[model samples]
Each structure stands twice: as C-alpha cells, then as structure tokens.
Target: MRAAGAQRGRVKRARLADVDPSLIRPALAGLVPYEPGKPVEEVQRELGLERVVKLASNEGPYGPFPAALEAIERATLELNRYPDGGAYRLGQALAERYGVRFEEITVCAGADAIIGYLSLATLGPGDEAVTGWPSFPSYVLDPLKVGGTPVRVPLERGRFDLEAILAAVTPRTKLVFIAAPNNPTGTTNTRAELDAYFAAVPPHVLTVLDQAYFEYVDDPDYPDGIAEYAKAGRRVLVLRTFSKIFGLAGLRVGYGVGSEEVVTAIAKVRRAFDVASVGQEAALASLGDHGEIERRRIANREAMALLTQTIRGAGLDFAGPAVGNFLFVEVGDDAETMHGALLRKGVVVRPLGPFGAPDALRITAGTPEEIDFLSKTLSDVVPAFR
Candidate 1:
C-alpha cells in the first residue's frame, strides 16, 4: 500500500509539470495581486504591539452614518436570500438624486468592480486601454486581465497629461480611465481640461471618470462627473463609490452613470447579486443623511489641513492641498525601507512602490489625534531613513 501511494504521488507531480504554462492567459502569470490597507489585527500580530494607527487605503476612518446602521439591522433578517441583482431601489435613488434615467445606472460592489465588468464586456486581446500612472492601479490591471494592452501616460506635474494620453491613442484604443483628485497625488484636472479631453478622444474610445473622492472635493474648478456625462458624446461612464466619504468602505457599494449601451454591455457580464443586501440598504440610507455627510466632509477637510501643516513643518515634500481625503508625501529613497520603519513604529501608511512612486507614500486622512501620531512617527523615522 505504501509503494502504491508513492507511485500515485510521483505520477501526480509529473502530470502537473507536463501542463504548459503558455495555456494560461499570457498577461496573468506575473500579475501581482492588489494590496488593500493593512488590517489592524495583522499589524498588531506582526509587531507585537497593542496600539497601531492605520492610515492606508484612503478609507474614511469614520463609522457608517447613524441611519445606515438602522438599514443594516433591518437588512440582517434577509441574509438567507440573494441580493436584488437589478438593484432597483438603489438605482432609483441614485437616478433621482442625479436627475438621470434608471437605465443609465448600474450598481456594483465597488467602482473597482465596475472596472471588472467593463474589462469583461469591452476589452479583448490586442485592444488598448489608456490611463495615467502614479494613479489607480486597477485601471491598468483590469485592462491587462482581459488581455488588453495598457497604455500608461506619465503624469505631468503630478496630474494627468491629457494631451499625451490623446496622442498615445490608436485605432485599437478601447477605453480610458481618468481618476479625479487622482490617487497618491490627489490633485484634480480643471473643467476646461476635461472638456478638451472629451473632444479629442475618438467616439470608439470609451472614457471612465472615477470620482471616488467626489464628496470630499471642495474645489470650485473640480468638474462634476454627473454633469460631465451630459457633455460626453458617444461613450462615457462616471464612477462614484460609497467607500470614501460615505464611510461604508466595509460594505463595498459603488455605482456608475453612463449611456444605456455601456450599462447594457457591462450588465451582460456583471456579477449577479454583487452588492450585498446590507450594502445596498446602507448606501441608500446614507444618501438621505446629508447632514452627516456634510459634517464628515467638513471634519475631513480640517484633518487634512492639520496633516499638511505637519508635513510642511517636518520639511517633508508633498503634493499640495489635495482635494481628496489624503496626502502624498515624498519620503526620499527606498520608500519600502521607510514604510517598514513606520510599520515597526505602529503607524500604517501605503508605500507607493506598486503605484510607480517608490520615493513616496500615500496616507489616508484620519482624526486629529491619528494625524498627529503619523506626523510624529514620520518626523522621527524619516531622519533614520535619510
């Protein structure tokens, strides 16, 4: 019996080695998985520290709005059943809020998930999708996952270079993703730039405007994505998320507004019941809680200002006055080293190595105390790194 088992194990190993890796999609093999914010538990376990501050992943540190808790409690009774795949009520709420038709909306688990649906529905082998680097990685990853070529235009002065992106476009270009108050840098393109960009892009090329931090934006020139949809000619989609200012990052609810055709194509490949029942309910409830949203938004702005001041006082280089609820600070050579030092010190921040900014780190805005802790840790640790 021992000899027979040994023979079976050998045969299994040999058979596995015989399968050609080339059979797998060529783009998928080396693809590194997305890294989310470091969980509190993981850090505590790693460092043997009871106290830690996690300011990564750009998530609002606040809990769900009061009304959202009620919705979650009510939805708890329906856990046995699948969520409404159509997301009728959520769709209706968003449509009414934006003054758009119901057919133009498609609710998904997150804006990142909508990117997945877009990739599955539109991208194909040899197709090209364009986006700015030092920005969201998903825009590049999603296209590659579908065997589409990703054309990354480098940011000019920490912002999207629209002209360069347009110049890079070819007949094979199928999609473009623009993240407003773009991640890492957190700067925005003006309304004039987007208008010019829309005009330059060909009708065959679809554009996705990711407004994940829309509610935090206070800039007068920050173009409204819902309004941008009206200006776009052929193919355009606006993405918004509940993960940021709505303080529902755990629930993973996001939505898109676009042409009926784009919505239809994405829906064709959309994962059914993607958004949870509780997530949908919480999102709907939060939308009506405008007072809470405004309060949180105002609070975030104050916290951001405090952090920016600290960054300046420490003589740290940073992108100025971000519209989003985060700041990008330059930490000199080998960001991973600095990142490790901070991790050891019980403060968590996102190193931008994967985002192509190895000299910098992105920090999500936290409360006054949290920001002060980060600033102090950074001041102490950064000198050692230098």
Candidate 2:
C-alpha cells in the first residue's frame, strides 16, 4: 500500500512538472501588474500608526454626496439578488445628462474597465494602439494584454502632443486613448489641438477619450470630448467616472458615451453585472444633485490652489497648468526615498516610478486639515532630500 501511494505521488509530481507557461497568453510576458496607491488602513497596520491620511489615489477628499450615501444605504438591502446586468437606470441617467441616446452608453466597473472592453472588441495580434506615455498606464496595458502593439508617444511639456500622436498613427493602428486632464500631470489638451487631431486622424482608428477627472476641470479651453466628437461624427468613445468628484471610488462606477455601433461593440465584450447595485444606485443619486456637484467642484479647486501654494512655499519645482485635483511635484533623484519618508510620517502620495517618472510624486488635493498635516510633514522631510 505504501509503494502504491509513493507511485501516485510521483505521478502527481510529474503532471505538475509538465505544466507549460505557454498555456497562458503570450502577451503576459514581462507584464508588471498595475500598482494602485497604498491604502490608509494598510499604513496604519504596518506602522501601528493611529492616523493616516491617504492622498495617494486621486480620490476626492470628501465622502460620497449625502444623497448618494442615502442611496447606497437603501440599496444595501437589495444585495441578496444579483445587480441589474444591463445597468438600465444609471445608463438612462448618464444618457440624459450627456444628451446622448441610451444605445450610445455602456456602463462598466470603472472607466478603466472600458479600456479592457475596447481592447477585447477591437485589438488583434499585431494591431497597434497609440497613447501618450506617463499618462494612464491602462492605455498602454490593455492593448498589450490582447497581443496588440502599443505605440507610446512621449508627452511634450507634460501634456499630450497631438501632432506627435498623429505622427505615431499608422495603417495598422486600431485604437487611440487620450486621457483629458491627464493623470499624474493633470494637464489637458486644448480644443484647438483636439479639433486638429480629429480632423487629421483616420476614421478606421477608434479614439477613446478618458475624461476620468472631467467634473473637476475648470479650464475654459478644456474641450468637452463627447460634444466635440458628436459634432465631428467620427469613431469616438468618451469615458467618464463617478469615482473622482462624486466620491464613489469604492463603488467603481463609470460610463462611456459613443455612437450606437461603438457602444454596442464594447458592451458585447463586457461581463454581465460588471457594476454593483449599490454603485449604480449611488451614481444615479449623484447625478440628480447638480448643486452638490458644483459645490464639490468649487471645493476641489480651492484645495488644489492650497496644494499648489504649499508646494511653492516648500521651494520645490513642479509641473503646472494643471486643472485636475492633483499636482506633479519634482522631488529630485531620490523620489523613492522621499516617498518612504512621507509614508513613515502617515502622509501618502503617489510615487511615479511605474508611471515612468522616477524623479517625481503625484500629490492629490486632500482636505484642508489633511493638507496642513502634509505641509508640516513635507517641511520636515523635504529639507533632508533637498
């Protein structure tokens, strides 16, 4: 009996040894997984700290709008059943808000999830997707996940170079991702630049405008992607999120607006019930309160101003003309060192190593009290690095 058991164990070992990595997609080779900002709870646990202010992720410093919280609380009771796979109510609300047809909208887990749907629906082996470097990693990542080539156009002055993006386009290019009010840098492409982009870019390529931070944008020249694209009547998908200004980052609700055909294609590849019931409810509630949206937008602008002032007072170099809820500060060669020091002090900011800027930090505009704490922490820490 012992000999028989030994033989069986050997057989199992042999089977395990025979497993090949090639069984998985070849595209995953050397792909580093996306690293989100460290959570507040995590820092608290690791360091045994009582208070940790997380300004790492570009989430709103405030909680979900009061109405949204009420919606979420009420919706929790309905969690025993699966979510509405179609996300009908939220879709209708977004369609009405954007002035687009219901068929033109597709809801997702988050705006980032839409990128996957686009990649699955459009990209194939050897197909090219063009995007700006250091903008959003998902723009580059999703294409690579589907065995597609990613053409990375370097940003000119921390902003998307529309001409360079146009130059990068080839006949093989199938998708283009433009992050308006781009992450990390918080810079936006102007109306004139986009008009030039749309006019010149070929119709065969699908342009995805990721407006994740659209609600917080106060710049007069910042183009409304949906309105502009609709006027052009081209292959365009404009993505928006409830995560930023709506303060529903935990719920992961986002929607995309495009032509019926484009939205249909993206929806076809999406998972059923990709968004949660509570998330849909909260998002729906968020849209109903337009006044709250404006108030939060105004608050975010003031917080961003305070953050800018704090950074300037510290005598640090930074990138600007930023209209989003964050600032990109140059922290010298030892950015990792500075990042660690700040983390120890219970203040969290995004270090841009994976975003390809190893010498900088992306600091979100946190609440006034949080910002004050961060300011004091930076004063203590920056002198050492400087």
Candidate 3:
C-alpha cells in the first residue's frame, strides 16, 4: 500500500512538472504579490525576542469592543452551522446607518475582497481601471487579476491629484478607485475636489471611493463618500471596513454601499459566505457602538500627534496632516537599514519599498506604553540614520 502511494505521488509530481506554462493566465505576467506587514509571532521567532510591538498594519492598538466580544462568544455556539452567505443582518445594519436600501449593500470578507469582486464583475480584456499610485496596492493588483489594464496617476504632494485622475480616464476606463485618506500618505481629497470629479468624470466609469479610515478623519471638509456619491445618485461604490478603527481586523469584515444594480453585479462574482458568522456578529455589534468609535478616534488622534512630534524632534520629515492612523516618515536613503534597526529593537513598522517609496516607513498608533517604547527607540535609532 505504501509503495502504491509513493508511485501515485511520483506520477502526480511528474504530471505537474509536465503541465504547460501557457495554461497560466497571461494577465498574471510581471505581477508581484502584495506584501503585508510581518506578523508578531514571526518577528518574535526570528529575533528570539520575548516582547515585540507591531505598528505595521495600521491596525488599532485596542481589541474589539466589549459588546463585540460578547457577540463573538455568542456566535461560537452556532459554529456548527454555516454563516449567512449574503451576510444579511450585517448588510441591513450598514444599510440603515448609511441611509441606503438593504439591496444596495454588498458585504464581503474585507475591503480587499470587495475590490476583487468589483474588478471581476466590471473589468475584462481591453478594459481599464484608473487610480492614484501609492494609494492602495490592491487597486493596481485587482484589475490586473481580471485581465484589465491599470492607469496609475501619480500623487501630487502626497495626495490624490483629482484633476490628473480625471484626465487619465479614457473611454475604456470602467472603474476609478479613489482612496480617501490614502494609505501610506494618509492625505485626503476635499469635498470640492470630489464634487468636481463627480461632475466631470465620464459616464462609463464606475467610481470606487475607498474610505477604510474615514472614522479617524476630523476634517469637516473631508467628504463622506456615501453622502457625496452613493446617496446623492452618482455612479459610485463606497468601500469601508471594520478592520480599521473598530478593532476587528482578525474577523475580516467590510462592506460596500452602491446602487442596487452595482451591488447585484458584485454579488454574482464574490465568494459564498465571504464573511464568517462571527465576523458578521462582531461587525454588527461594533457598528452600533458610536461612543466607542469616538473614543478610539480621539485616542488615535493623540497617538498620531505624539508620533509626529517625535519625528519632528528627531529632525526628520513626514508627509501629512495625516488623517489616518499612521504617519509616512521619510527615513532618508538609509530607510532599509533603519527598518532593520527598528525590527531588532522589537518595533515593527511597514517599509514602503513595495509602495514605491523606498525612503519612507509607515508607523501606526499604539497604546501609551507602546508609543513610549517606540518614541524612545526612534530617538535612539533615528539620529544614526539621519
């Protein structure tokens, strides 16, 4: 029996090796995989350090709210059953909050998943998706995955150049991804800018407004994607997630509010039971806790201010009035070296080589003690880099 098993394995290996490379999708050519931040466990294991603080992924330092914790506990009892494939309850909650109909809400595992679904549903060969570069990697990647071209407009002054983005739109452009409070840079597009974009953009394009860090923004001029576009009857899909301020990154729940037609199309392409039962419950609970959201928002603002102050104190420069949970610090040409030094010091921040800025790093807000440790560590290591 063992000999037969070995023979079958050998045959399988041979067949796999003999398979034609041409069978692979041509769209995948020259595409690099997305590089996420290093996990806490991996960092600890590699460095043999008992303590490590990760501010790499832009996740909140806090865990899920108390109500969300209870929701998770309750959800565990029904583990034997499958999750709601449509994520109906969570979708309903989001719909109510956004003042959109339930049919207009499309729930998915995360904002990334929604991007994938939108790409799959709307893009194909010879199609194009326009977006700002260094915003979200997924905007560039998802379109390529669906055999569509990506048109990248470079950011002007660390923020999306709305005029440049509009100029880039062609007749073939089916989607335009606008990352509000863009990742890495954390700068936002103003209401005036978005209003002009909506008015001028071609009718063929479906605009995707990604507002994953919307809750953290205090600027009164920062436009709410839903109120501005989706509710106001424009061809827009607004993407948001519980993964940011809500402290439910592990649960992987996010939602989109769009027209019923667009949401229906996305539903056709997205995976079944994309968001798990526990995630749905937790996200629903998290959505209802406005006070907790405000608390986290204020705390994040304070931490980011401290981080910025420390960076300036070190005689370093960063981009923003960053409205998100992180700062994009310019670490000089020695960013790689500085990153390694911080890693050795048991602080994990995101290196921006993949985001096309090799001279920078993204540091997120952490708890007070973590911030203190990071501040001291930065003070110790930054002078050498500069």
lDDT of each: 0.88, 0.89, 0.90
lDDT of 1 by residue, 1-386 (tens): 35444542353233434576678887897788888878988889767888899998899989899999999999999999999999999999999999889999999999999999998899999999999988898888888898889999999988999999999899999999898989979888999999889887888888999999999987888888787654344368999999998889999999999988889998999888789999999999999888898899899989988988877877778886589988898876867887888999999999997887889988888999998898888788877755
Models sorted by TM-score, best on top: 3, 2, 1
Q: Measured by C-alpha RMSD in angstroms, how accurate is candidate 3? A: 4.4
Worst 10-residue lDDT window for candidate 2 reads 7-16
Comparing candidate 1 with candidate 3, which one achieves the higher TM-score?
Answer: 3
How close to the true structure is residue 246 of candidate 2, measured as C-alpha lDDT?
Answer: 94
Looking at model 1, the pairs that clash are: none
Off by over 4 Å in 3: 1-18
Candidate 2 similarity to native, TM-score: 0.94
Alpha-carbon shift of residue 283 in model 3 (angstroms):
0.6
Clashing pairs in 2: none
Q: State in Å the error of residue 146, model 2.
A: 0.6
